[model samples]
Target: MEVIAIQKSAFDGMKNELKELLEMTEKVTRKYTPIFKAEKWLDNQEVCLMMNITKRTLQTYKDKGLLPYSKLNRKNYYKLTDVQALLEAGQPYNTDGNGFTDQ
Candidate 1:
C-alpha cells in the first residue's frame, strides 16, 4: 500500500537523520574533549595555569621544598590538594618552609 511505503520512507529518513545527528554529536564532543598525556602527571605548564603562577615561580617553590611534588621519570606532578592549599594560603613569594600562609 502507498501508506505503508510512505511510512517506511519516513522511518528510513528518520533513521538517517538520527545517524547524522549522532555523528555530529561525536564530532562536537571530540572537539571539546581534552587530550591528556600518558605520563599521568601534570606538567609545569598545567601547574602554572592551576596555581596562577609563572613557570619560574613554580620552579622556585619546587626548589625551596615548599611545594611537595612527585617525580615520574623527570616529570613533576603536584597534588591537586597542594595547589588548592597554595591558593587558599595567599602567601608572599618567599618559601619559608612553613607551607601555606593564612589568607
Candidate 2:
C-alpha cells in the first residue's frame, strides 16, 4: 500500500536514461558480436564433392595454402568464401579427369 509517487520530470529523465542505456548496449553487442555465425562452413567431404576433387587433392590445397580452413577436434573445416575464392582464382584442380590436383 505504498502511495509514494515520483515527479513527472524525474520519471521522464529516468525513461530517457533507460532508453540511452538500451541503445548503448545494442551498439556494444553489435560491435563485439562474432561473425562466425553469419559465415558458411564446410567439411572436407563437402569441399571435395563441391570441387569434384579427391580427399588427397583437398589435403594438397591445405598444404599449398590455396585454401584457408579451421581445424577442430582433429577435423578440418573450410569457409565457403575461401572455397569460392579458390574456384574463382583459377582451376587449381586437375582438368584432365585425373583423380589428383596440381601441386
Candidate 3:
C-alpha cells in the first residue's frame, strides 16, 4: 500500500512535468513561425478566378462586407479561408439575370 502511494505520486509528478514541457514546446514553435505563413493570400485576379466572377463583382462582395480584405501598398489581398467559408455557405451574391449587378 505504501509503495503504491509512492508510485502514484511519482507518476503524477512525471505527468505534470510532461505537460509543462509540451506547453513550452508549443510556445517556442509559435514564436518562430510567421503568422502569415498559415494563411493563403489571394489577390484580385486569384479571387475572381476562384469565384468564377469578374473584378467588379469581387468589389461588390467587398462593398457588401461579405468578404474581408487588406490593402498592401496599392493592391488588395484576401484570405483563402474567408473566401472558402463564403463558398461553403452557398451562392455568393446574386448577379440577377445579367452577369453583373448594380451596387
Instruction: List, residue by residue over 56-100, the lDDT tens digit for candidate 2.
Output: 878788988889999867998898999999888875767345664
How high is the CA lDDT of each candidate model? 0.70, 0.83, 0.83
lDDT of 3 by residue, 1-103 (tens): 3544468789999999999999999998887467558788899999888888778788888998999998977999999999898888964666655667744
Candidates in descending TM-score order: 3, 2, 1
By descending lDDT, how would the candidates be arranged? Answer: 3, 2, 1
After best superposition, candidate 3 residue 39: deviation in angstroms? 0.6
Residue 84, model 3: lDDT of 92
* Residue 72 of model 1, lDDT score: 60
lDDT of the structure predicted as candidate 3: 0.83
Q: Compared with the true structure, what per-residue lDDT tens digits does model 1 show for residues 1-98?
A: 35444587899999999999999999977864543232244677888887766766787788877788877668887766677777788634833345
- What's the TM-score of every candidate structure? 0.48, 0.59, 0.60
Q: What is the lDDT of residue 31 in candidate 1?
A: 68
Superposition error at 80 for model 2 (Å):
0.2
TM-score of candidate 1 versus the correct structure, residues matched by position: 0.48
The local lDDT score (0 to 100) that residue 54 gets in candidate 3 is 74
